[model samples]
Target: MDFNFIGTIWSLLPPVVAIALALKTKEVYSSLFIGIVLGAILFCLSMGTGFDGFLSHLLNDTVGEGDDAKSYGLIHCLSDPWNVGILVFLVVLGSIVSLMNKAGGSAAFGRWAAKHIKSKIGAQVATIILGILIFIDDYFNCLTVGSVMRPITVRYGVTKEKLAYLIDSTAAPVCIISPISSWAAAVSGFVSGGENGLALFCQAIPFNFYAFFTIIFMLMIVVTGFDFKAMSKYDERLKEWYERNGWQLDEVSDTKLQIVEHGVGAKADSKKPKETKGAVADLVVPIIMLIVFCMTGMVYSGGYFDATSANYHDFVDSFAASNASVGLVIGSLTALILTIMMFVVKKTLKFDDAMSCLIKGFEAMVPAVLILTLAWTLKSMTDSLGAAEYVSGVVASSAAGLQMLLPAIVFIVAACLAFATGTSWGTFGILIPICIAVFPVAAPLRIISISACMAGAVCGDHISPISDTTIMASAGAECKHVHHVSSQLPYALTVAGVSFLTFVVAGLTQGMGLMASAAISWISGIILLIVALTILKRIKCKKE
Candidate 1:
């Protein structure tokens, strides 16, 4: 149904009410659902329909209607190739993680890390490196890194809040920078016209200040052991309450902590983690194989080796046309099989145990998957209300002759939309097109403006409680959801502040072309992060 509402701003209501309710209630699912309901209501009202019409539309979106029903509503969203692929990918990856944990790979890895790491800084740094290494997808990165590193970090007295932040900081940030990733596929699909989506995305990387600087800022925060406000309380409280007292985390948090600390799941021997038999290879091999297989899967789906395709000889050309969702599922499924066999053959875990992990894995991912689906549905609702078109119109209208200011403006627009909607891809679908339309495809400003859209979306996702990445990060770290969001906001905003200035610099220097502007803006952003962190550290010292 037509939901334009005669050009009114009511299209913005769903996300606005949802974000407000989420923050105020420290809840995500209900808030998002409520927002979805509100948007459906708005859509109905705009069409001059009533509750019955709303139910009919909801049914059409969620379930099947007659042949008159379009194939692109809420229900159809679940069947969308991209959406289904991601869901299956999450399930498979979760199962692989579960299998590893059940077979003592994770516990064994933690024991090994504790011996070699020897310090808190080393533990945190190891987590960062591992997080960066898992640049396949943000969902995979968050869960795998969190589960593998949680035990090790806990040993070093690193707070769950801090670990959650680290997992989150690395997830969307690292994935966005990776050329072969699910995120790359999503970003690639958003841009229209010349240079191809992947090429444009690659060109825009240098201008993506928020992402690269988040990594930098995250490193500095960990290396310096900086803590402030709620983070400080949680860090010190946990350090004193659990680590200092030698109390189990069971005394500190909820059941999820039990799962993370004890490695819960059938055949997961929580009995003696110290005696958990495994080598560093048990941990390293599966991860490496997963990466390799996933990459292979991606390239394969892109038809890299398909001789029939004209671009078969060129890997980059193939990958630019790849389907991220398909490749991830294929790779993760392959990795899961190989990992299970390795565990069973080694007697690290039984075949039966591996079989049980399948269910456990799916169970673990249920929360992330459910949240993602709801987020998607909410996006659907807003989309039905024409939010993207409205926002795009506003941006295009205001963007004339303001080339230098456009990047920052796009950044703000993208950030607000992502924050309220809690979905980066949704923001991308809205803003990237507007950016390309406003600045000619050949203009340096086009690349900068597009990068701002991406960077802003990531920034918003980093902090928003309702963002799937944020929720997954919390699940991975076993931190309370709201705790993760609230604790990470200050840190995210700090990097975002510096990123805004860097975008301004980039926009100003666009005439110098990609490499020059990228270098200048990136270096400036790093300096800004260092200076900002230094000042904050000094202020903390003075307060102490």
Candidate 2:
């Protein structure tokens, strides 16, 4: 596809406006809304619309396009199935999230977790594990994990900024690595159609530098208790709030150790905390059901089961026929309804309180929903304008000896595109086919290249402020979006840099032992950690 400079420029304007507004205003929803409106305006201008026509086009694009050329100016771009699907998923997910919160499931989980998990690092670790556990869907994983883990982390003086970073890092990074995750499904589908898809995926795992390293980096941060410069600012702010308000940390501390040691005083209540029977069961069973149903759905959709002497295709045809979204929607709704019933039946919450919880959950998700809409709108605008394709084409064309540095090139290109689009899946979709077509014969290089694409996509998606994961992370931490972005950038870049270097070495060596490469990556990470720790110590010393 040929590039349209004007279209590209116009398409790029939205994110630029978002970034500018975000930086200047630090109001995430406002920034995203402005970006969406700006994109609509640019779309109108591109179509040569007048002010009235532009307004009409904006409505048409947001709603649906009609057959009229004037209507075409407004709605043609967003009429695509993918765009519509994205919008539906975002809104529905928002509703689901709200329901989960409203049912007191999230609060119950948080309160329950806080009782068991002690120490700041443990809370962060729990957040990461929860993020990893909810791997079936990144959107679900990011928001659900963040919502459940935030209050516990906040109680321990674990800054929301840090919590957001942990949530963001684990969400996409863990999803890409898990075979059954939405991210893996998308990439696997792409590779399956290509030569030796399974082999390519396996080989790519070793070179998924970003995902591997980011996870390690998160763990290191958790273990070492080192805060980045921006994160220190958050820490200071949190401390100031505590000091000025004369908030007694001991009074609010809810950890099991604290409660066991201090008894009633630990809970900020003199009365014994009421234990609802099956409180844990209420949380655990629904999650288990969601997983079982989703896996069964995937298997059914993929046609993996056939008791009769059915052919493989027949099995796949029957089992794998349903959309994944249907499974998620059904699973989330079932879980939410069941949780509500469980709470009500046990008298853990009255019906009215249960309803109130659901409303609060939905309200908590308002920011995420708005940001998601704008992000999707930005994505639609870019895709329609061919911004990603144009940029990919430019990178593919301009790079010298792409065959030699295919892995590195893939990493850079995928990272840039994913960052631009705020979607790893979209980046994978765009780049995987191109990689497969270009590197048809070189199996090792193909694996490496595709892996690089996945890694880069995850890396960029994890770090990009406009990414749904990033937004959800901020919401999870209850931190400012810019604060999360600023605090997390240094850590993300640290991993990105190390991953890039590892990719270079891996590409040059052409599939050197995975252990050796992992060791090298680990050694580099240790060095980064030591340096970070040293710097943090110096800062601490200076502060004291």
Candidate 3:
């Protein structure tokens, strides 16, 4: 409850060390190892431990158990329910993705998509839409959408760099807006006890300036077919590759191509591309089932249909009250089972291949699994140090006219924290408690402040180079991570600037009116479109 300055400062040491190591080594795994070790060292020092005791304690805490040898600080932080859920979700999702990949589902979808999409811009738009649709999990959004979209985008001359931007933009941005998403579940769990969590989320949506505008910005780029200076640099490289290789470079590499071709050959060898019976059904049926089961599960978990079918809103209300994760787990399991059945019935996959596909799907998730584990560890360490609470206290105490600028300050704080943590959900988790507790003292301003925090978290996560969504975006596009970071930064910054301005004006005018704020956002979106177009024309001129 109270600030522990020394404890907080010491707590920050691990993440700082981790970042420094990452930069120095340019190896993500090594950097995470350094971070974990640094965190353990600090924990040991704080708890008065010898090196051996420290090692024992660290191992115990890392693997989710703690004994008398370990400090309570280490145990409680590591065993947080949210943390446990996140870790499980990451591992399971990874397994599912590996399965999808192994079944040739992803490649089949990609090849089919590529043959139809003719232009670079169209492919980018398709990628964006797919990103939006896969809102259940950001990790899923990134890998599946990216893997499926990558081949198509490549065939149409869209730079991998641009594809990364689109994928990253859509992942967290869309998830934060949807109330049923895993991201929302995490955020709501933090802020849901007394307050109307759903309403709070809906209120935040209008002012979620970064997410609102990022979508607009992406659409602008797609519609105007414009590339910024940084993006243009990457696009030029792609064009050069195409000119020399005669679009051969546009095709998938021989290894991936071979996999797809072999799968095709097994089905039918050059004799008329017979629409694999229920190929569309193979894809569509399972997805529809996923949605239906997920919704039904949510209703059951939330207690939405409790022996009465009076009205639709009440039914929805019942669903909201149910346990969401139960629904998610059930839905995901059903989808997985149905997918296997579809493969068998359609002859789309053999029993051995299907089993192999599942293994491969889990295998592909290894990197994600590792990254998630490290990320959670880092988050636990930070929480144990009490960094977020300390900062929240400082802001609550020091700021002037706190009521008036509460929203803007929340936004700024959330953004800064998210940037530091490279996680929007973590940022939201850290700030929501503080916002809920502090904002009520200011009455109406509480709404604005809470909204600001949500918006800020989204903005920060959108741009953070270390963010999982950002990494996924790059992976999805097959672009260098740095390239995605560099190309996307300017656009993200531009939106942030405008969002800040809008928040300031809204605060000053006491205009937290949703329609007005939305109108301003729309106008701002249009201006961004014009600017993107102008920039694209300039790039064209330079090329000519």
- Summarize candidate 2's per-residue lDDT along 377-472 as a digit string, tens digits: 666655555577676776667544657577777888788777777888788878888877776555556666778899989878877778877887
RMSD of 3: 5.6
Q: What 10-residue stretch in candidate 2 is worst by lDDT? A: 256-265
Candidate 3: lDDT of 125?
A: 83
lDDT at 438, model 2: 72
For model 1, residues 1-544, the per-residue Cα lDDT tens digits are 4545523578888878887887789888898889888888877777777878787665454323787444324676687888899899888888888887777777678666756887778888988999998887898789889978988887766788899999998899998888777788788878766557888888888788899898888888888889768688886676455554445642332222344355323133335324556677777788888889888888888888789867573676556677878887888889988998888888888898889999999998888888788777887777777777777788888898687889998998888778876789888987888887777767999889988999999998888777889988998997878788888888988889998998889888888988888888878888888899999999999988
lDDT of 1 at 205: 84
Off by over 4 Å in 2: 1-10, 41-53, 61-116, 192-199, 244-278, 300-322, 350-357, 399-402, 511-544
Please say which candidate is ahead in TM-score: 1 or 2: 1
Error of 1 at 461 (Å): 1.9
Candidate 3, 184-274: lDDT as tens digits? 6566667765766766776667667677778887797688766678888877775674555444544654343433333322232334332
Q: What lDDT, from 0 to 1, does candidate 3 have? A: 0.65
- Note the Cα lDDT for every prediction shown: 0.80, 0.66, 0.65
**In what order do the candidates fall by lDDT, top score first?**
1, 2, 3
- Quick one: ranking by TM-score, best first? 1, 2, 3
TM-score of 2: 0.81
